[model samples]
Target: MDLTINDRVLVVFAEKAELPVAELDLDQTFEEIGLDSLHLMEVALWVQKEYGAVIPEGDLHHEQTVREALAYLDARTR
Candidate 1:
């Protein structure tokens, strides 16, 4: 099965956060999932490696929800 961009992003975040993908909610902020700046940076690096997209530093913040972050990355990937 082909995973959509949202699914791929959720998988990355879930893996980094040490949580099950089923537990990740799109509306939940990164803070809510216990992901800090370091984790976000790691995720950004992963995105860079996986998609060749350079996510802006400002976009990786605690206030950004999973869905919003996915959208930002998805936009750049396309």
Candidate 2:
């Protein structure tokens, strides 16, 4: 089965956060998930490598929730 963009993004975040995918919520902010700036940078790198999309650090930092970030990336990838 093909993973949707949402699933893919969640998996990346979960992996980087060292938490189970089941533990992550789409409404949760990176801060709420215990992810720091370093983790966000790592996620940005993964987005660049995986989707060929260079998300600006400022934009990434501005994202309020996992869902919002995923939507931003999905827009760029498409």
TM-scores for candidates 1 onward, in order:
0.90, 0.87
| Candidate 1 stretches greater than 4 Å from native | none
User: Best by TM-score, which number?
Assistant: 1
lDDT of 1 by residue, 1-78 (tens): 999877888898999889999999889999999999999999888888988989878778999999899888889889
Candidate 2 lDDT tens digits, 33-73: 87888888888888889889888876776347988888888
Global lDDT of each candidate: 0.90, 0.84
The clash number for model 2 is: 0
Clashing residue pairs in candidate 1 are none
Residue 75, model 2: Cα distance from true site in angstroms = 0.6
Local distance difference test, candidate 1: 0.90
Q: After superposition, how far is residue 55 of candidate 2 from its true place, in Å?
A: 0.6
Candidate 2 clashing pairs, residues 3+ apart or interchain: none
